[model samples]
Target: MTDPNEVDFAHTDAADRKRREKATGLARYIWERDISGAELLDLPDAQLRKLAREAGVNPPSTRETWTVVAELLDEKSRWAAAHPGHPQATPTHSDEKIMWIKRPITPWT
Candidate 1:
């Protein structure tokens, strides 16, 4: 029988592993699409607002693009700081092709 005082290292390790996995996934999603603060500025206002909502900044104080951009950048910086050592996946040609295929078809495309 296991002692009640014994700590479960396996459970602790598993939780840590899961957290790292999530962080790595976030890092990949950010890097793969080049979704940085500066790049976000090039996006349409509608898309910027959508991103703000997704970033948890609901009903941003102002509709100004810069405001939302700053908030999103701050959120990204905070996540990076919290998840140190998260893997940044290097995108290959195949990855680029897949991204191209998945990209939304715009009137300009």
Candidate 2:
């Protein structure tokens, strides 16, 4: 079945692609910098806000920033698959389920 969410992102509008790239860059900073755990608690409000913006997060509060981070990561993982009818990312459900494919299926699968 054709998934409605499926799209040839390579052919998508350039602006959208750029925005996604930017957002992902910001999301990476949060994880790659190793500040996710500490900043979520100890940082002052102003610095936290700055970090969030640099991470391309746009939300009213730090908690909401997580959603933006998630969106960027999710979008990034999607590109691993250039086509549909297969998983792009194993995103955690609200229950934090681990649902990603550990090993890719063979073409014969």
Candidate 3:
């Protein structure tokens, strides 16, 4: 059985393909910056809800990491298309600190 949410990019129209490419590019940018969906999971519920709103996606009742990532990607893709010249925000100092603290401490010092 096929998954309802699965995107068949191959057969999609040019506009759809471009949209997917933009979203994929957005994901790639985040990953390149060492930003993982796990960091988003650390966000408070209200923040997640706000992210969903900004992304133009209906916030899910359950705060699932993947769902949040998907919604964020969707919003970012649309936002990028709308503002091609705008600079993308990198992980802030606080964001990096949170990720660093969340990492497992190693015994080798």
Please provide TM-scores, in order, for all candidate models, with all chains considered together: 0.31, 0.30, 0.32
Clashing pairs in 2: none
Q: How accurate is candidate 1 locally (lDDT)?
A: 0.48
Full-model lDDT, candidate 3: 0.52
Model 1 backbone overlap count:
0
Task: Return the clash pairs for model 3, or none.
Answer: none
Deviation from native of the Cα of residue 7 in model 1, angstroms: 57
Output the lDDT of residue 95, model 3: 51
Better of 1 and 2 by lDDT: 1
lDDT tens digits by residue: candidate 2, 44-75: 56655666565566523434344555565545
Candidate number of the best lDDT: 3
Please provide, for model 3 over 34-98, each residue's C-alpha lDDT reduced to its tens digit, 9 standing for 90 to 100: 44455656667876565445445555455433444556655655665687676653332335344
**Model 1 lDDT tens row, 10-98:** 35878556544443443334344445555545556776455445434443333343434445555666676677677532322235433
Q: What is the C-alpha RMSD of each candidate to the true structure, in Å?
A: 14.3, 16.9, 9.9
Residue 56 of model 2 has an lDDT of 66
